[model samples]
Target: MSEPLDPGPFFHGTKADLQIGDLLTAGFRSNYRPEVVMNHIYFTALRDGAGLAAEIAAGDGEPRVYVVEPTGSFEDDPNVTDKKFPGNPTRSYRSVHPIRIVGEVHDWTRLTPEALQQWRDRLATIAQERGEIIN
Candidate 1:
């Protein structure tokens, strides 16, 4: 395990073999929020294989990194936006943006069903802060 680039409760890693339940951070920029750091979990894949390359088709070229729940403090960060929300907020999975893999998550694979549910609930709360629902 290594120290995360940004502050907060998050797991960070180098771009290696990513798997479901792995929490990762990507560098992203949005019109509303620039130089924003987002966290995502590798939920599923469209292709087959273990490493990121395998997730991409033979000719697709683009890394098909499908993830769930992107949470951030954008709503609370004065640097990112003027709007501030104390609670860390999450946007819909549909709002996922193209990002550069900055770090990978070290913990997450051993989550129990109950633990997973708790995480989901937390994520839902964050999403609602953005006025979006996670299905």
Candidate 2:
């Protein structure tokens, strides 16, 4: 039998609050534990300028549903004096790009390639503005 899929810790939150630079705890290419779900992603509104208006205006990119890789630490946080266990990993000044949208929080209907493009365009813009995109 195939090993059970491990999606890691569940993120209990509403997708409504997601914004252009907000971090979304979601699976990468696949919904498997091996995927870096913890890495999270930055969200953008749907294309046609149709989505949360506040979120769209908040970003420096075009209005569209997109997500780009935010910075992530290459190593875990180092334990400091007095502090026993290291807290969450630190954020780096780097980013992984080609903003891929595998799925949504509630497993919303799958998006078409065209729809994905709208997202990509927005993400690309965001990455450029932040100067965090890495080919």
Candidate 3:
């Protein structure tokens, strides 16, 4: 078999308060598309990327980044890899199986208010245009 694309100390981002050993699973509504339930749980190798995800996640709770370990096979997130960005520069991946929370990260960069507004504006535009989330 081919080697894994990344040897990640993988991270998942969200607003949910979770404990160490908590399991993040699939079947949640898409953060980008609330109408659809996600079949895969996504994570990234980049801490800041996860932070961005947490910042934009659909909730009012505090954003959080969790160090995670995938419980099964994962693949490059098709929503970004070779689609919006070429070749998984984001180092994002998704798995059908659950990912366990090992610990929390406290030092990821948080976006400024203006920057956060810009991102929200971008997401609103995408939603208005009905952006395709590659499930």
Residue 16 local lDDT, model 3: 99
Provide TM-scores for the models.
Answer: 0.24, 0.23, 0.95
Candidate 2: 10-residue stretch with minimal lDDT: 73-82
Candidate 3 ranges with C-alpha deviation above 4 Å: none
Local distance difference test scores for all models: 0.32, 0.32, 0.94
Ranking by lDDT: 3, 2, 1
lDDT of 2 by residue, 1-135 (tens): 544222122121122444554554433421112223334332223222223322323334433333334233222212211233344222111123223333334332344568656766765575556533211
Q: Which stretches of candidate 1 lie over 4 Å from their true place?
A: 1-84, 87-98, 102-110, 122-130, 133-135
For all candidates, what are the clash counts?
2, 3, 0
Global Cα RMSD, each model:
12.7, 14.9, 1.1
The lDDT leader among the candidates is 3
Arrange candidates by TM-score, descending.
3, 1, 2
Tell me which of candidates 1 and 2 scores higher on lDDT. 2
Instruction: Return the lDDT, model 3, position 26.
Output: 97
Best by TM-score: 3
Q: Write the per-residue lDDT of candidate 3 for residues 1-135, one digit (tens) a residue.
A: 989879999999999999999999999999888998999999999999999999999989999999999999999999879867779999999999999999999999999999988998998897788568888
Displacement of residue 79 (Cα, Å) in model 3 is: 1.0
